[model samples]
Target: MSDAAIHPTAIVGQHARIGKGVKIGPYCIVGDKVILHDNVELVSHVVIDGNTEVGAGSRIFPFASVGLQPQDLKYHGENSRLVIGERCTIREGATLNPGTEGGGMLTKIGNDCLIMASAHVAHDAIIGNNVIMANYVGIAGHCQVGDNVIFGGNCVVHQFTRVGAHAFIGAHSMVDGDVIPYGMAVGNRAVLTGLNLVGLKRRKFDREEIHKLRAAYRMIFASEGTLRERVEDAAELFKGNALVQDVVAFIAAASDRPILLPRNGPTLD
Candidate 1:
């Protein structure tokens, strides 16, 4: 409290834990149940309420509402939690909600995330580290967004969907299913277009690994066998390839939503 700087117009609850070097700018409101780690910054006109915790060094820009009650009709003041991770930047006008009882009572955003302006993270969404959500992206409730995922502007992900690690959701995509690891999804219905080869290359994945993944992808999506059969065959063929195995395991995982396939592939009912 001694080292923290709070503007005169800011209304921070007395019980709110303010760590050293924290900066609460003018017109900010922080509720009693909030816990701000060291060096956190609220850049004016921000409201953080509920049983929420913001990690160290995270900066929340103007008009961003965090740790608010969930929009779920079933949410009945259950003391659900919202946890934002370290060094993340939550841009202006973003809205983040806490979880409900039906969805583990926790909404968590991992470290180094860039939640762009006007993005919305609905209740119970578990977002992984280094993720990027472009402006106007909306993620519905209970969605699982894996590490290094990138959501382009105006993208909308349906509730309960799972987006795998390093996946890319193109602009204006309406994703309603499970997107596999390193996969690229685009368009209105959001079919799996291909691997996120550009991302892989930028991240320094070697040519041999990319080649193996491409081959496995082709085999798994071929119009020959059932999806389950194709996955099994790919698993056997790319047994030693870790990257391919990641895709295979993501597809094999139990999910309420269907695994997204290529536009030409057989659709899952």
Candidate 2:
């Protein structure tokens, strides 16, 4: 379009589809299979390649690399796609890789996500809306991250893990298991320390609901009983509370990795 602004230093491939009012700044390289939706802004030195589709009003900062080939050793140059939703902010040096042949050939990021600088979203990661990944966070391949999840700086999520909605992961945590909804996970191995009380309160969760969830957390992790025993007790005690029920269901549905157990004191290990 005539009103669309593209700097002379940028390289837009012949088959690339750039929408109305899109702005490409200096030294950006948009590949042939890429599609940039309306009002999207690409800052300097960004490279958007592969079969990537960027939605409207999104912004890519300097040195970000989106939609590259999957890093999986099993990837064999198969056709894949990376879909980024509207109004998303990808900060400088963020790298989002496409899916591998084994991972369904698609990686997705939902609307309004703030992916901070130097964050890495590996092959086939599916991130839901309103997610905030802080600086240098690393999400491994095929991880499913739910809506409104907040990952602190330098957090590392292992492959095939699921982070449920409204979960808050503290900085430098290494998450290897599924994170339950409304939970706060912290420490090196990412233990479910407690309910994300402050975050829930900020999100307008009622005080009564918070109390119920806190009670559920106490039964799940703080109590002296075994995990199976705790779940059985929680089923009887907190059946009326939907949030508590969700936590119980989460524990029941966990397959390989168990939820983190609470320690007696604040030990890093």
Q: Give the top-scoring candidate (TM-score).
A: 1
Give Cα distance to truth, residue 206, candidate 2, Å: 1.4
Which pairs, if any, clash in model 1? none
Worst-scoring 10-residue span by lDDT in model 1: 260-269
Q: lDDT tens digits, residues 122-192, model 1? A: 99999999999999999999999999999999999999999999999999999998999999999999999
Local accuracy of candidate 2 as per-residue lDDT tens digits, 1-269 = 56679999999999999899999999999999999999999989999999999999999999999998888999999998999999999999999999887888889999999999999999999999999999999999999888999999999999989888899999999998888888878888878776677788889988897787777677766447677897789878988988788777766876565555655522221
Clashing pairs in 2: none
| lDDT top scorer | 1
User: Which lDDT values do the candidates have, in the order given?
Assistant: 0.94, 0.88
